[model samples]
Target: MPTFPAQPSPANKSIALCVLFPVFFLAILVSHFTLLRLPYFWDEGGYYVPAALDFFRTGTLIPQSTVTNAHPPLPTIVMAGWWKIFGFHILATRVLVCLFAAAALLAVFRLTRTLLGEKAAWVATLLTAIYPVWFAQSTLAHADIFAAAFTLWAIALYLEPSEDRPQLKVAALFSLAALSKETAIVTPLALAIYELSLALRASRNRAVPKIPATKHLKSFAALSAPVLPLLTWYGYHRFKTGFIFGNPEFLRYNATANLSAYRIFLCLYHRIVHLTLHMNMFVAVACAIAAILMPAIAPRARLSHPVVTAISVILAANLLEFSILGGALLTRYLLPMYPLVILICVAIWQSHMARLQWFWLAGLTAVAFLAGIWINPPYAFAPEDNLTYRDMIVVHQQAIDFLQAHYPEATVLTAWPAAAEISRPDLGYTTHPYKFVAIENFSLIQIQRAASDPSGYDTALLFATKWAPPQNALSLSRHNSANDAKYFDFHLDLLPNEAAAILHGEVVWKTSRGGEWAAILHFPRIVDARLNPPR
Candidate 1:
């Protein structure tokens, strides 16, 4: 391994952290200012916000209002604590998540500075902050940001070169990461395997026999220590919920149903795209690939061999693991890896390009990332991947506002997150809960089922559940019955007018933005005082 610079003094490190954190926090808050007050979107409304509210209201780790997914309680605990101090508000929740994003950026800065230098650190951190997925996630109350923050800090500690490395601190951070989200255990587990491989290789060598192998063995043990806490969490969850992973449906969706070899292969391809090309990340990565072919202008800017190997192992492990694990190929799941990718690309640019060339490349890449935040790709993707999520929330809020203004007492028919939005005031959609009938989604079959009993609800609030762009090639090819049955059950949502016809209602109000849309349908019926009178 190449000799790395000495670690910063404790006092200096503290000062840098203090200065960088507020700067990063303020930048993130300003960038996400408009979105900070918006109601929770998608999974935030569906699961995370509800779970945190349950913990905040009742002090129960297992959410009473929402089905327990057996996710670790750290995020819930943190959010509940924030609510206690700040007094439960959407702004407070978003600000807290921004703090986590800032912390993650600080860790990225420190990691890149240690691996390359200060200049490289600045470029890497700046790019990571503006990356569409990371920027969008900054204000969203999700476990991924919390876990990414802790995981990046832990990786920084692990990679920092010192005579006596802080193995225990690394393990503790890894444990905290896992406690934030169970999937975060993958990082430490990946590192542990990497350490074991190093130990095995050292053992095979006669020159450095026992000492190097024993050192690596110790590192492996420490890295693996995070598993105990994670297992303990699972044990407690099983004791409480009678399931180790989660509800059967959660287990089936995230794990069991994803075990098919073909699906895994498909997911692997998608994962590659997510890591290398999603949200214009290809701009930086492609530049790095081209730069690699050029002669080094500053060979000293290259990362040490061990550092590159470790980062590569981390990226590869996450790529393969997430492909086999997550049901939905959400980009947010790979949050930590984006920083590593950026760090490598920035380092390569610093190594090969002249100062002017490096400046232009980084500038162009930043512009691309910023553009990605507003521009939707020509494929199906989670709205949360970019500002499309904000568009989604805005449209929903408008529909809800219209519903409240005209028919506050009417029973509203909608799918979750809208159902959750209208029913839960704490989710920031309304001051009071509305009567709502929930369906799975806005698909034709689901709408038909709702149509079977139009008397159940007086108003129908329909929205685009899946983000299918007009030129979505994936949607065109993926609409087949075989694909639907084997993979995701892809279904086209009925247009507001079409759905209204089926439900014997008229579209009263509708709005759309950035390919997402929402509408309210009203059904009129005569009420006979003799049969059903007002109380």
Candidate 2:
């Protein structure tokens, strides 16, 4: 195994952490300044913000407004507590999430510095901070960033020198991570299994002499400790909700429905692509792969054997666990893993390239990542993956504004999250709630169904619910009536004009940006004076 510089002194480490965190937070806040007060987008409006609002208003762990997903309450608790102090504003919510992102970056820096060196740490942390998913997620009130921060801290502690390692602290951090997001339990669980394997190997082979087999057993015990709290959360959830995981639909969508063998296989392929290629991650991955073919120029540039083994275990476990679990193959679910991937890539670059060459390579990788934040890929993806989410919010806000200004009394037919946006002022879309008739989406079939009852609503709000890039590769391969409806929750949305024609309405206002679009339709209807008389 190769070695790097000595770890920084305790005082120096403290100073560095203090400096790095604010710098990271400032960078994130400045980058997201325009987005800070924008209305919640997609799942934020659909679930997280509502769940947190329920807690803020009622002091309940289980959300009353949204369908309870049995996600742990740490994010809701934090958001509610922050709202208590800051008075429940979108800017406050976004700033709190940005703090979590900065903490995660600080953990990344510490972990990389300990394992490699300061220079590698700087490069890895910078890359992670600007990586499209991390950048986009930084200001979003989602549990993933909360979980990623604690999980990275736990991993950093776990990777510390054995003499300085704090087993209880690591277990506590892992528990906090699991509390932040249930799926985050997978990390400590994976590590526990790794420790158990090591203990078994150590007991069987006497040649392995550094730490006793008993120490590995102790490590396993610490890692397994997080499971207890997670189970307690589920038990409490069952007691309250009569369900262990979540409501039936939540369980079926996230777990049971995802159990098919073919779907798991397909998901594994997508997971691999998500980790290696999504959002221009392929640039760094490709650079690292090419560097692997070259001779080592710096003996101290490699990660220690144990560090490599631990990272491999984590990567494999998360890849397989997430492949078999999540209904949506969201990149944000694997947030902590990106920093590790980038660290390894940086280490590989340091090992083979000259200083100037490594600088150029890192610079190119950063440029690619920055470009990815603005450029939509030519495939189907969640708009939340990049700045496209801002477009979604802007266009939706425009449509809602049109409705507010011109047809405030019209019952607007629309789909979530527009449904949620127009109905919830707390989400930052409107001052007063609008009367909305909700549908699943603006798909042709759904619109046709809504058209059947024209008397129910006088206006329609429509949007592109899914990204359908021209010549979308994934759409070509994966989109079929059965598979899309069953697996992807996907449908082809009618254009605003087509939808209005079917609904016997005219398009009143519409807007489009970055392949995302939203429109409002107005229907003329006779008013019954006796039923709805002027005041």
Candidate 3:
């Protein structure tokens, strides 16, 4: 086995592993179990859970009739099968996803142990398990944790010294990563670069005879051959749908080759700024400086370091992919790099900062973990921040209760999130649930259809949440104004002004909870007032 910079005593290593696993597991469990019942917020209710239900009904890989080719079908299908077996309950699905989370924690521990040392492995695993984003994402039914787990395991196996059929195992693991998420195709690319870098270092050291650059290129290409299955999947989609991935609308709105360079810079800037601001600002800034200065301060140790090289490649590939392809730039888009970010911090600490009291390192990790709680919890710190699971749960539950009590049979005008919640029979609303129309990018026309305004549906519910013009139009709305196009992917163009115009009527019921606002507007009253204006 190859030795790393830090090798703890065998007894110490065993003690660390024994202590780390249970503590990390308990942290994840305690942190996530409470949030499990927080209704399918964000993409869970909006797309994934519904797609899983659709898969259950249709028995096909393409779960949604909308067939968002934006992603491969693996996550949705897996969730669907789990839902079928376990029954479609929020806690059950969340627990299933948590199993993936546990796998990720194990992968992180093993990878760090193999490359760094047992002590570093404990630090990395604890950092990963406690890190707010990874913890929160693990609880949610998303493909990201699954992809990250598979990719981490794949890289771990790829770095391992030769065992029987190691290459084959690595190849299969990479394939699994791709199956979990399309962007995971970058895993093998990063690994290929890592391999080539090692070969180059070996040749320079006279460990092997100098080889032609073309030979190295060919070898890298061969290592990347496992990505062919991913290519074939995209090919099948193209052949069937005439669109390359699935969601042409998403591609149209988010991608542009002509402006890829510009988009790349902007996206990277956005991500970096958000990371620094929301994800433990001080620690984030410190980590960035450490990663930058590590090479200059310790060139020899930094340059040829296998783990650092692999992490750098993976991070670079992820950034380049999003920059070039340019779609709805979200924090989640950078999730594959989350583990890398934690690992980079661990590497820096292991290299030069270990002399500091051990509690200092643990203190910083604790700060990052706490920062995530505020980020993930609704109205925990930011009152108007709707970028949380709790916001949806609190607001949607109020609206659902109001509608059930008064307008039991009324058609509810809802966006995807609320629509998905109301449509479900198991939510304890009523035996016969209310009807709803699930619209995204809300508009007056959509509201009209959802309410069945002209027909006999007398009451309409406009379950409004964080809808306002961008506070930072210069940054967020640079591409388009709120009146023209959505500034962010989650925020609709239904600005306060637009919503007021549509929702002008006698308010039957209203509730404001967890930084989200909900209201039920009387359609008849609004119509009568419009027709018979009082003298």
For candidate 2, what is the TM-score?
0.94
Q: What lDDT is reached at residue 5 by model 1? A: 44
| Model 1: CA > 4 A from native | 1-15, 209-211, 471-486, 531-535
Give the per-residue lDDT digits (tens) of candidate 2, residues 230-257: 9999999999999999999999989998
Q: Between prediction 1 and prediction 3, which has the larger TM-score? A: 1
Candidate 3 overall lDDT versus native: 0.61
- For model 2, the run of ten residues with the poorest summed lDDT: 1-10
Model 1: C-alpha RMSD to truth?
3.0
Q: Which candidate, 2 or 3, would have the higher TM-score against the true structure?
A: 2
Please give the CA lDDT of all the candidate structures. Answer: 0.86, 0.86, 0.61
Q: How many clashes in candidate 2?
A: 0
**What is the C-alpha lDDT profile of model 3 across 1-535, one tens digit per residue?**
1112333334544644455556655667776667777666656665666677777778756544444655776787788788788887878887877777777787778767765567677777776666656656777777777787788777766655332226666777788778778888876876677667756655576444444444444546655876887888788777766778667666766664325455467666656654444445347447646645643433212213545666677777787676556455555656657666766666566565433533376567667676665543311122222235465567667777777777787876566556656776544334466776455635656654544544545555555543433344324333443322332344443543355466554667767543356666555543444576689
For model 3, the superposed segments whose C-alpha errors exceed 4 Å read 1-27, 64-66, 161-165, 193-223, 235-243, 254-260, 274-277, 281-284, 287-304, 354-358, 375-387, 424-433, 437-460, 463-502, 525-535
Pull out the clashing pairs in model 3: 69-246, 69-247
